[model samples]
Structures are given as C-alpha cells and as structure tokens.
Target: MNKQTRPLLTLDQLWQFSLQYYSAREIKEACLHLQNHFHGNVNLLLTLKWLDEAQLTFAPQDWSTLTHSLTHIDALLRDYRDLRRKLKAQVSDALYKETLHFELQLEKQQQTALVNCINTLELNPCETPQLVEQYCLQLGAERLARIFIQPVQAHYHTP
Candidate 1:
C-alpha cells in the first residue's frame, strides 16, 4: 500500500479520508463487525487508520486524553446507534432513514472531536502497522486489525 507520509492537518482532510475509506463495502463491513463484536468505536478506529496512513503515532497519554474527552460524545453515539438499530424494522422507511441520517451527523461530530484532540498534540512518525496494532490491542480486537491495516479491495475507488 502507498501510504500518505504527510499528516492530515485539518478536520476536513480527515473527514474526507474517512468518507473515502468508509465508502468501500468491505471496509464498512469490517468496521461494523469490529464495532458490533468487539465494542469498538468506529470513529476512533477510523481515526487510527487515518493516523496510520500519515505514519503518525499517538503517545499513550495523548490517546488516553483523547478517549476521555470523547466519552460524552461516544455515549451519545451509542445511544443513537441503538435507537437507529431498534427502529430499523419497527418504523417506516422514511423514519428509519431519518434516524440513520441523524446517526451519521453524530459520527461526524465524533470525528470532529477526534481531529480537534489530535491537532493539539505533538505526534511522532512511526510504522503504520505498529500504530494500528497498538490500538487494536488496546481495544482487544487484534483479530480484526488486519482489516483496517490492509488495502481495500481492488474494485473500490475513492469518490
């Protein structure tokens, strides 16, 4: 994989990278799998991938602070996600779609907070796999780490 060496310096760049990364069906499935099965935070996982692509390493203290700061937002995201999933079959299609749209907005908010947290810290260059592996280990989701680190399927293209 040809990883980007330059760090993403703004929230827009991180959000764009995330949108492109998440657009792949396989990538989306993998992320959802991790989220559902391993109790992973999708936005945090995506942020790790973004940082990995830039070859940036988050110090342990910084990682803790970042996660701490996102606690409230994460709780809200989980609540909305649960509500969305619960309403999927019980509600009208339009209502379900509205819930999904609101959930996506929360996701963007989480990403924005992630970018803001990282922007204040001093990060160092590191091997891409190491950074991702560390995060996976932290989440106890080492088995699914490869899905985030490996390149997406050949058929997927950036939009």
Candidate 2:
C-alpha cells in the first residue's frame, strides 16, 4: 500500500492562526494587498506563513487539498473582483459602493469556508528550514515581487 501523506496544520488550525494574525490591521492589509493586487494565492500564502510561524516542515503532498484550494470560493471572488473593477468607474455611486461592500462580505465568508474544509488533519510539527524559499518558489517570481511586503519577511522565514 502506498503511504498516505500528512500535512503540517489542519485546515481549521491554519484558519485559526490566520484569523489571529490577520486580525491585526496591518497584517490583514498586507494579506489583502497581496491577494487583490498581486496574483498570489491568499490561502496558501496565509497557510504557508502560519506553518513557518509554528516552525513546521512543508509536506508537498499535504497540499493535496490544493485542488479544493479555492474551488469553493472561486465564483464569489470572481464576482467580487469583477464588481470591484467595475466600481472604479462608478466610485461615486452609493448603491454600487454598497454592493461592493456586500460582495466583500460574501468573499470573506467564502474564505472562511475554504479554511474550514480541511480542518481534520493534524499539524505536523518540525523544524522547517527552507519553507519560505519553497513558498516563494510556489508564488513564482512575478507575483512574489508584489506580495513580498517588507514586514512579511519576519513571518515566512525559518528561524
């Protein structure tokens, strides 16, 4: 039998950490900027950074749920993104602005669902050495350029 792979933090655990860290206005701003402005995968970015915080190793297969990654919320995000773009031209419309705000709330709910989906897995604690590099590699060079905010360095690196 093939040995099944394990992940560092369960979806729920990862989400909990995300909520805690992102609760800070600055961190949340940075994550949102990377997600909105750059093409970086926000969930992966948040999860990867969280794993690094706990000093855990990166198990590639652990991300098997990657397929399920944004599937649940892709549509909502797409809609929100589209509306956000449209709102740029109609920024003065109160109704349009309110709609954007509603879409943003829906987007947040979708993210919450995404993080809650794979909550069963346990966090595999270890001394993760090159996880930051791995995350950077996954993010790719172009996206990383915008996503890699200065203070973000303190969060994603090995100790």
Give the best candidate by TM-score.
1
lDDT of each: 0.79, 0.58
- Point out where model 1 deviates above 4 Å: 1-8, 152-159
Runs in model 2 deviating more than 4 A are 1-38, 91-93, 129-132, 142-159
**Residue 78 displacement (Å), model 2:** 2.4
lDDT (Cα, 0-100) at 52 in candidate 2: 62
**TM-score of each candidate?**
0.86, 0.58
Question: In candidate 1, what are the lDDT values of residues 1-159, reduced to their tens digit?
Answer: 125544346778878888888888888887898889888888888887877777888777787877876897999889878888887889999988888888888988888888878877788898644666677788888777767777544427647
| Candidate 1 CA-lDDT value | 0.79
Show the lowest summed lDDT stretch of 10 residues, model 2: 141-150
Lowest lDDT 10-mer window, candidate 1? Answer: 1-10
